[model samples]
Target: MNDLETRQLRYFVAVAEELHFGRAAERLGMAQPPLSRAIRDLERQLGVVLLRRTTREVTLTPAGEVLLRDARTALDAISAAGRRARHAGEPTPRLRLALKPDIDGGLLPRILDAYAGQEAALPVDLVLGRFGEQAQAVRDGRADAALLLAPFDDHGLDSEPLVTEPFLIALAATDPLAARPSLRLADLAGLSLPDGSSADQGPASGWHDRAGAHDDAATASIAQDASDLPEIFRRVELGSVVCFFPASLTRRYPRPELAYRPVDDLAPATLAVAWPQTSRSTAVAAFVLAATTVAAATQPQKRETPQTAVT
Candidate 1:
């Protein structure tokens, strides 16, 4: 209808594109019932049937086919107009990004400093949160981008590796093994690890055996398991089990009460920069470039020998 707005046409086009009312409703941020009503209203206003729907499938009718092309053209033109207007925005828009708790140390700090020095007009803001929630925020457009440990595979998203960091060991300053500059995994034969989270969810091949109780300090641990969250941190708190973590993370969010050292043979952890493929903001690209540069400059982990011991 001539009286109908471009917004309704846009809504109709989205439903037409997806051909699924539920998905369209979700995208529209409305309930299915209201979406169905809106579509019916649109059809009534146009005085033409635009969709062919049934319980098994939904398809565009001949009328919908005609409307689809026209709607897309109109929407694209409007979007282009908006982008042109947005081009006048500040060249460096402050970028809001999400990050893993493990990155509070070296990697993020270096990136922020690099961005500040290179793009003085744009400042970088890194927000720390759970990985799953952060990834979702990027997809939903709540965040400009995010930094996450890898294994993320999601549609409509893009990711790039930023760093590959190795694991480190942490203990009280009084622990006997702390005196070594760096120790082989085999050297921890009868020693215990204290951090629970890294011990379980992380690789434990050389440090733990995975056969002991959560609180069994005398049994000794050789593997880190993520499956049991509670038990892992508990033992670490009591100073009975030594915990392992990505070296970068440990440096960022350091435990003043604990001393950390590197495990020579453990594999490094990968950190990735992720953003929605739909983003066209120039700031996002600038941030990514700066971040990748820091990744490139990142030093390969060195073998650590401890200088203290658990008291």
Candidate 2:
């Protein structure tokens, strides 16, 4: 079979995502008949029935599902290449760094200052995203590097550990557990915690023991729904749900009604600077060096064992 063209992959992705030729064509700003014909041609060329079309609806076959996933990654890489090339062509290129705001373990300002002082450093642009988006932004070239927590999806990325801090549980001051000096993961088995399915929660937000045992029953008992930290804190303030966060958050977001207690048995959260494995930019290297330097100088005791790469 011939290699698939980018245009064909784009067309297939639109159709597969929408599962409707008319809608997909509309989305692609094209006519429906040509879109349908193109899909048919694609299927014929591949000799695979990618989609099952009934009178009422369309659904992807197993092969279609696989192609959809791979096609998205391919398209993202192509787009990233274009973006990087344009940035490189600029007369005064800048480095874009992605991170969640106020979630950098109190090291962002120092890192930025240190980077700015470097002779090779470029002007850094901040691309703030919600939790769990930093790695993706780095992977897709939206940013040159990202400050992200560990236990994240590290595929195709190289990361260096910056700071590691204990995880703490946030609870309402009125709650009985708030009075405890410290708590353990098993202590939260029956209490309501923030829903992990929410996108704005980080990878460390999941309620699991130090040995990595997931408490299914506790997860099932989670009743509060929160999208962001403020919402989670609001729920905690209302005694609706308890939440866990890295210890840095306590200093960044202290609340009168919420009490943050150490979770003795939970895994410590490690903040790392991650960049794409294929990156060869001097600015990125300089930024990483600055980040590590600042982290070590500012929080030497909190620095975890140096990690050369993540996955």
Candidate 3:
């Protein structure tokens, strides 16, 4: 069997993501030639060509595609293992949770209280991340668990359903569509959706992408350039764009400038608690148990309210 080092996988992932040797090398703080040589060595050892290259561009071969996915998982596991080990040696270990800001809809305070009531509860650290970043936080060991929105890549994580709720469209109060009682996906045709660079794709892939193809408005989306939520809101206020959000947001962050309309065609949002698949931490286990117990008592039904968002 060919021996592959973690360093090799790291180099391969950098190159694969950048699709350019120079850019990948720059990102890794290494020279292009050494990075190139290392990838060649990796391919030789594995007995497969991972990348196809020409003068103009480099692309992944079939084997390369498989390796990229596996390599990401392996790299994440290694990183998480190291972080978890270091945390274990601390004077007083703590559990970190990650989640989006202001999306928890008033369930966080109670969950914290309940978890603290447990005999084995550890000090909980909150890691607030942008949307769709919860998965990465758990994978990287920055968090023991996360409150993540569904339709995210759960490849190396274990999750439990905490809350499920329908979606709503956020439009400027002054916009004509704001007066409508309810709207369907067809109503959004040809309108540009708000854009955000820091926003994770969340569940906007596969079926989501296909839905856009059926209507010009469905496919009309702004370029991925908005830096933050406030900026996206600014765009909405200007009547230039619109965005979809969980119904809970209407209660969590109601704005006089914004109007929320029920969207029947979009899939309901599912908030979940997710942890690294390989985690064996007692504190993490206890927290997950505490969270589930609290959720069952509170919601006890689908698409209900008072769901907490824990990170």
Best candidate (score: lDDT): 2
**Regarding TM-score, does 1 or 3 come out ahead?**
3
Candidate 3 regions off by >4 Å?
Answer: 196-227, 300-311
Q: Please give the lDDT score at residue 142 for candidate 2.
A: 89
Best by TM-score: 3
Rank candidates by TM-score, best first: 3, 2, 1
lDDT: which is higher, 1 or 3? 3
Each prediction's Cα lDDT score? 0.65, 0.80, 0.77
Could you tell me every candidate's TM-score relative to the true structure? Answer: 0.47, 0.74, 0.84
Candidate 1 vs candidate 2, lDDT winner: 2
lDDT of 2: 0.80
Which residue runs does candidate 1 get wrong by more than 4 Å?
1-93, 101-105, 117-123, 171-235, 240-242, 252-265, 299-311
User: Candidate 2 on 1-311: residue-level lDDT in tens?
Assistant: 99999999999999998888887898799999999999899999999999999999999999999999889888878878988988889899999998877779989989989999988899999998766678888878888899988877787789999999987888899999888998877677667656543212322555321112223435434421233567778888998777777888788888899999987767788899999899998899999999999888766466579779878
- What lDDT does candidate 3 reach at residue 72? 96
Residue 99 error, candidate 1, Å: 1.2
Candidate 1: tens digits of C-alpha lDDT, residues 192-246: 4442333323444323223222333442342334224345444454567766667
